[model samples]
Target: MFAGAQVSLYPMADGFVGVILESLSALDPYRDQLRIETDDISTLIVGPPEVLFPALRDLYCAASASGHHLVLRTTLSRGCPGEPDDPICDTSCLANPSEPLAQRQANALETLRLAPDMGQVADAQFSLYVMGNGDHMAEIMGCIDFLKQSGTFYKSKHFCTRLTGDAGAVFATLQQAFCQFGPANGHVTIDLTVSANSPSKR
Candidate 1:
């Protein structure tokens, strides 16, 4: 499987150059776990979901907290045809990982609270795993309905749906989708990949 993200962060503030550099530095520590490449336009990171999500959360949280208006734009892809395979894309790395994405989100949310309001656009992809018995298709449709009403959404051929909206609201909606609908009887899990960008095309 191929799992990777190409991201670009723009900090809108005075002395933005240093701010951007410092903000992007947050991903440096994950060098061992991911294959990261940075160029003139964006940074591309390839790895498994376990490491990918945490790294993205940390990087976004740090960049948003930089006391400046920030915009993050990214294109995330996985399982695309003709893609190269990599070991890190497998689920084995997460079998016993110490920290998971849910935990990382808690921390990211804390930091994101301090970020100023800038009317940014956050885009994300989610694959809801509907398990257990009882109207799985109905439940999936329900989730999709809510998301569609919540913001802009696109159903991709890659088997994931994309959503875009205000950063806070987008994540909050996602949290709700992940938490509430998976009732005690029904089981569901979501794999999410998110990105944000300011001054987006409307």
Candidate 2:
């Protein structure tokens, strides 16, 4: 049940160092709940999805509040076969493997509806990977359907889906995509990039 994320933040501003350091404060509240370590490249946050996603949302919103173009790149994973199980990652939130896909999608949408509004807009593109055996595409397609129904959905793109809205809903959608659809104890991962205050808008 090990789960975590490797996150790197890029701020398009002259005071990038300050922005980065300041944004990190957003994770203070989650420090006791997560094992976080930062080096030159990225920060690794080890925790359950329940705490992981909100920590990410707050961190991103803090950076976005600087009014500078900001980009957050994260690689999130749960139940990786190669990783050792950790007690810190324990949680009851993952969808049951036997749960019907339609039911899972319904639950995901309901969760999104209750996501908090962070007052910051985010545009994100990501790909969900449900690793290991079983009908992978079916699970992926079911997640895609959930995303389309998610209010944050922006559009579909090559190799990934785009989502736009309040940072809360967007991150919640990403969390659902990671938590639902796949086997409860199976390996699942997400490659995600979220942007805010970008100068160019298509």
Candidate 3:
């Protein structure tokens, strides 16, 4: 069996990278097949179902402890008859490849039975801390403004942006925001949370 997943790492990029590399190395022994690809904003993993689950779980733990919030989406491969699909394939199969990690997570979460009566809305809370850059606060605000102008966030606050919409909308927004931070100088840290709640409950 094969599985693929995408995860969003919160906090400093270096911290997130460190956590993932560490977890993957620790889980390597159990992985019958493993392949990882990462860019600035996210990471993708493809491997045997058994190995991927543990790796995913461990990655989550490490990121959480390091104060890096994450959003994960997984798919179980049902290989075609007489032909086993590639153990690791392209990332296009991921649901809403265009959406941001946060939105994707919120959308997936809304499918759960968290509360029977509450309406489901995509929610996000995140903070960014930039080190080594003087006037860090201003730069961060500039980044925030770029995100807002780009319409990546539904409603943006000082540092915590709240998105209320379907999962796709939320995810797209967050991913866009992550990309926006690329040009800024200094070390960047992000703390993110994506969730859903019934309208009745919120």
Candidate 4:
């Protein structure tokens, strides 16, 4: 008869409502019975089983599409449901930054090292800018993806990717990640650093 749902979105984006709809569309379609409402803060949905499941799925999907790490929880009842669950209550759904920064940085570099080679060029050091808002986990993941997907370099485990690349290539990679950051780029700042040993003079 009634239920409470809580949806929290991080690193909010433009057309966020659309992202939510797209996400919902991917889930069980019987959710038409539900009545859903969302504000800048969260989304609240109510109705029977036929309605709730689909609504919840959309909430999950939209957050995912917008590059937001999200969490949703439903409290069921006979008449009325309370607010949606807090993202912190569910560890699995929440983004975590419990790992040390050094570990995160190392993981980013390791991802860069595993890519295919670029002809004669060697990808030396990876300069990753954990761009976007304060959602550290998402930004870390973003940096990792940029390192691996961009055509600038290949993967190597022995040496640091940040220490060996062409200067231009490294900057290009940093620029790409910054661009993908979207809204997160507003409140937060970007930083990228790389170091290469001195080469012999011409």
TM, every model: 0.53, 0.98, 0.37, 0.28
Q: Cα deviation in Å at residue 23, candidate 2?
A: 0.4
List residue ranges in candidate 1 displaced over 4 A. 92-202
lDDT of each: 0.61, 0.94, 0.45, 0.39
Minimum summed lDDT over a 10-residue window in model 3 is located at: 111-120
Best by lDDT: 2
In candidate 3, what are the lDDT values of residues 49-79, reduced to their tens digit? 3344445444544444443444433322222
lDDT of 1 by residue, 1-202 (tens): 6666787877777887787788778898898999999898988888865566556666776776665667666565554445776887774322111344344334334433443333545667777666666566765666676566554465553777887665555655554454334332233456666554334543
Which pairs of residues collide in candidate 3? 11-190, 100-171, 100-172, 103-170, 103-171, 118-198, 118-199, 119-198, 119-199
The residue-level lDDT of candidate 4 at 110 comes to 46
Every model: Cα RMSD to truth: 9.4, 0.9, 14.4, 16.8
Q: Tell me how far the alpha carbon of residue 80 in candidate 2 is from the true structure, in angstroms, after superposition.
A: 0.9
By TM-score, how accurate is candidate 2? 0.98
lDDT of candidate 2 over 24-119, digit per residue (tens): 999999999999999999999999999999999999999999999989999999999889999999998899888899999999999988899888
The TM-score of candidate 3 is 0.37
Pairs with backbone N, CA or C atoms under 3 Å apart (clashes), candidate 2: none
TM-score of candidate 1 relative to the true fold: 0.53
Ranking by TM-score: 2, 1, 3, 4
| Prediction 1 global C-alpha lDDT | 0.61
